[model samples]
Target: MLVAAAVCPCPPLLVPEVAAGAAPELDAARTACSDALSVLAAARPDRLVVIGPAEKAGRGTYPAGTPGSFRGFGADLSVRLGRADGDVVAERELPPSLAVGAWLLERVGWSHAPVEGLGVGESLAPERCVEAGREIGVRPGRIALLVMGDASACRTLKAPGYLDERAAPFDAAAGRALGAADIAALEALDAELARELKAAGRAPWQVLAGAAGNAGLSGTLLYEDAPYGVGYVVAAWS
Candidate 1:
C-alpha cells in the first residue's frame, strides 16, 4: 500500500536552468517539494514510485537510472532518476513530468528506497487509473508515490491555456482534496471537466487516491500557486 505520497506540479520551469533569469519565481515551490519528499523518506517505504501524465496509459516503466534532459527547453543540463553507478543498463529519456520528479529526487538526494516511474495518460479512465494504482500498491513491499502534474493551465489571460472562469474553482477544489487526503474527492474528479479546464493532474491524482486505498492518511498542503498561470500545488500525505 502507499505509505506516503508527495503531490507536485510537473513543469520544466521547476528546473532552475530552464527558468534561467526567472528561476527565483519557483524557489518556494522547490523548497516545498523538498519538504514533501522529506516526509516520504520519513515513512521508510521499501519502494518509491513516481507517477506522472503521459500521452498513453499504462506506458512502460522508466528504470531508476533513466536520463532526463531540459535541452528541449533551451537548457543543456541533464539529470538521471538515480545516480549512475557505472551499470550498463539501457538508457531511456524520461517524459517531462517524470523528469521533474527525477529532478526532485535528485534535489533531495533520495536514497531511502528503490525508485521507478509510471506514466498515466491524461485521458485515462478513472477506473483504469485506480486499477493501475492498486497493482502498484500490491507490489512486494511498502510503496510511496511522488505524483507530478499541473492543476490547470487557464488561470490567467496570459496562461498557456488562457483564462477561464472555471479554472480557479477547479484548482481550488483540487488543492483542497490534496491537502485533506480526500480520496473520494480525488476519485470523483470529473475527467470531462478537468480536460475542459486543462488540468493535467486529474488522472495522476486519481491514481494516488487509488493507491492510498482507504488508508486515511492525513495531509498537509505545503504550497498552492499559479506562478505562470498554471496551477501548481505541493502537498504531502502521511
Candidate 2:
C-alpha cells in the first residue's frame, strides 16, 4: 500500500551543475524538494519507487543500479537509482526525468529502503497509467513514491511550448489537486488538453492518484512557481 509520496518537477535544470550560474534561482525548489523527501523518509516505507516521464527509449522498469547521466545537458555527472545489491543488474539508463529523481535521492542520501524506478511514457493513456499504478499499489509492504514531472511548459512567451491562454488554468488546477491529494481531481485531468499544454505531469500524477486511492494520505503544497516558463510544484503526501 502507498504510505507516502513526494511530487516534484522533473526539469534537468533542477540539477545545480546543469543550472550553473542560474542554480541559485531554484534554491527554493531544491529546499522544498528536500522537505518533501523528508516526509517520505519519515514514513519509513519498506520500498521506494520513483516514477517519471520518459520517451520510448526510457520507458519501463529501471533497477536500483540503473545509471542516469546529465552529459546530454553538458554536465559530466551521473547518478545511480540506488545501491544495487547481489547480482541484480540495471539494463538501461534512466530517462531524464528519472535521472533527476535519482539525483534528488542522492542529495538526501536515501538509505531507508530499497529503491527502484519506473519511466512512464508521455503518450500513455490515463487508464493504462492508473492500471500500472494499481499494480504497484498491490505489492506487499509499505511503499513510498517520488513522482517527477513538470506542469505546463507554456507559462510565458519564452516557455518551451510558448504562451497559451489555457496553460495557467491547467497548471493551477493540477497544483491544487496534487496539493490536496484529491484523487478524483487528478484522475479527471484532461489528457488531450494536457498534451496540448505540454503538461508532462498529467500522466504521472494520475498514476499517483491510483496508487494512493485508498491510502488516505493528506497532502501539503510546499512550493509552486513558473521558472523558465515551466510550472514546477513541490508537494508532500503522508
TM-score of each: 0.96, 0.98
Tens-digit per-residue lDDT, 62-150, candidate 2: 98888999999999999999888865666678899999999999999999999999999898888888888888888999999999999
- Candidate 1: global Cα-lDDT? 0.90
Identify the leading candidate in terms of TM-score: 2
Question: Worst lDDT window (10 residues) for model 1?
Answer: 83-92
**Model 1 per-residue lDDT at 28:** 98
Best by lDDT: 2
Query: What do the candidate models score in CA lDDT, each in turn?
Result: 0.90, 0.93
Q: Give the poorly placed runs of model 1, Cα more than 4 Å off.
A: 83-88
Tens digit of lDDT per residue, candidate 1, span 1-238? 7799999999999999999999999999999999999999999999899999987656558877888888999999888776545663745688889988999999888999988888889999998888888788777777899999999999999999999999999999999999999999999999998999899999999999889986768999999999889999999999
